[model samples]
Target: MKKRVVITGIGAVTPLGNTMETTWNNVVKGNSGIAPLTRIDSENFQVKVAGEVKNFNPADYIDSKEARRMARFTHFAIAASKMAMNDAGLKVGDNLDGERTGVWIGSGIGGLDEFEEQHKRFLAKGPKRVSPFTIPMFIPDMASGRVSIELGAKGMNNCSVTACASGANSIGDAFRVVQNGITDVMIAGGTEASITEMTIAGFTNMTALSTNPDPTKASRPFDKNRDGFVIAEGAGIMILEELEHARSRGARIYGEIVGYGATGDAYHITTPAPNGEGGQRAMKLALQDANITTQQVDYINAHGTSTYYNDLYETQAIKKVFGDHAYRLAVSSTKSMTGHMLGAAGAVEAIFAILAIKEGMIPPTINYSTADEELDLNYIPNSCKETSVEVAMSNSLGFGGHNATLVFRKFN
Candidate 1:
């Protein structure tokens, strides 16, 4: 028989706040973390705002010398992973079996900022002036590599780089590992620190970024006037452990991870399949995996990127999956506040989903002033909702046509 998996701890370093507690509190309060772009000079670009992590001190989590040598994305991964391990009250080779503890973190564009800087240095001076750690800093898997080393996880150490679905995919894959009895505990989630000139320029050129100068009004997912996603940077980590392992350790459970569904559009590199057909399959698959009917889900954390196609297609997908019951369920896009944390969005949103199940309060989709008739689901517009959330689902759709969904049930 397959083992059961439950989430014991959560950690995040997001634009809304540096720690998971602050981020979740701000999200519940309907506060925006986006601001005028300070990571890069926006004077030359059309986009002027972003959800950038603030007041982060790398030395707070990792050795200052090692932190400097590693990339910013790795810093986030290590910090969030440590926070999660601490919250889970587990230490490899101490409280838990080192060989049974693993790590799987994801990042879409691992360390583009570092690469851009190194490229500039190489161009300005010579290759000799470039840092020797450039390759390690730029690799997407470094986050997982560093975390496994730092935390002494001797089992699987892997990273997924599937664009926006990176985090969700990582968590889902890790879930499989634990469910199959491959490991007792797994550190899973995603991290990204790609806020840089190149990322901005590329996104701006593709018209994938919001050009609204007002940070307050920038990221408006599902709003009729929504323009585009506000690119952001962050990391979200969670501790996924076998239920028996957790119970044996007396670990506090946040929620039980009951289902995961991942799919490929195979339609386009960037554009979503029509009506989000792949997304539909993913949701249906997740429901099937959980052995639950559509009406059982109380809330959905949409992969609402504040983009025209994602919002419309995802809404259509939900409607198709849930039918009339979709009207009864509440669906909200936390990106309205978190501003699309790219690779980290899925994991962070999953954390929000579990929290909703645990706290019975669902975060709102702020700046949802205009309602799109085509997308008429209950967005829980503009304010937090207090209710009994028995089950929550989080969706993540990535640029490479990756679609992932996770289901979290209230722990008994």
Candidate 2:
């Protein structure tokens, strides 16, 4: 029989807060993490605002000298992963076998800050001026590599880079690794620190970022006036352990991850497949993997990026999959508040899904003042809802047409 996997611990460093509880509490209150872009000066840019992780201190989690050697993305990953391992009550080389505990973290555009800084030095003072750690700091996979080294994880260390779906894909891949009995535990999720001048200008030029001057009103997902997504950065890590292993250690279970579905939209490099066909298939596939019908899904954490196509197409996809039952279930986009965390979006949102199940409260899609006619759903708009959710589904659709869905059920 396939091994069953359960989430025993969770961690996150988000725009809302540096720790998971602070972030979750703010989310439940319909608070907006989106604010004026302070990470970089927006004087020369059209995009005036973004969701930036405020007041974060890497030295709080990593040694000051050691943290300097890693990129910002790796810093976030390490902090979150350490928090997760602590939450799971497992220490370095303790309570778990290092050979069987792995790390899988993803980044869509890893270390853009590192790259920009190094390139500036290279131009100003030649290649020799560039730090020797340039490659280690700029690579996407470095998050996983450094995490494994720091945490003593020796099993399947990997990274996924499928745009916004990177986090979910990494978690899904890690799930399979444990389910297949290749590992007993996996530290898996995604991280991103790409909120830099080049990334912002690139996304702005493509009209993929919100140009709204008011940060509070910018990321209004499902609202009729949403222009584009406001990019953000963060990391979310989860400790996924086999049920038997968790029970043996008497670990606290958050929820059981029962299903994972991943698909690609070969139709476009930057847009979702027409009518969200890929997303629809991914959701259906996850339900099948979970052996549950559409009616059994109580909540759906949407990949609602607040863009025109994503909001409309995702609504269509949900309706197509659930049919009339779509309106009956609650669907909300935490990105409406968190902004789009890019690679970290899925992992953080997955934690939100599980929290919704555990706390019996669904986070709201805030800033939803005006709604689109065709994009109607419960949304739980502008206010949190206290409801018992037996099964929660989180969907992540990314650029390059990546679609991923994960199903988390309330543990008995």
lDDT of 1 by residue, 1-412 (tens): 8999999989999999888999999999999999999998888989999999999999999998899889999999999999999989998777899899999999999999989999999999999999999999989999999999999999999999999999999999999999999999999999999889999899888889999999989999999999999999999999999999999889999999999999999999999999999999999999899888999999999999999999999999999999999999999999999898899999999999999999999999999999898989999999999999999999999998999999989989
Residue 314, candidate 2: Cα error in Å is: 0.5
Model 2 lDDT on a 0 to 1 scale: 0.94
Q: Please report, in order, the local distance difference test score of every candidate based on alpha carbons.
A: 0.94, 0.94
Per-candidate TM vs. native? Answer: 0.99, 0.99
Worst 10 residues of 2 by lDDT: 88-97
Tens digits of per-residue lDDT for model 2, 316-376: 9999999999999999999988999999999999999999999999999999998789888
Model 1's TM-score against the true structure: 0.99
Model 1 worst lDDT run, 10 consecutive residues:
86-95
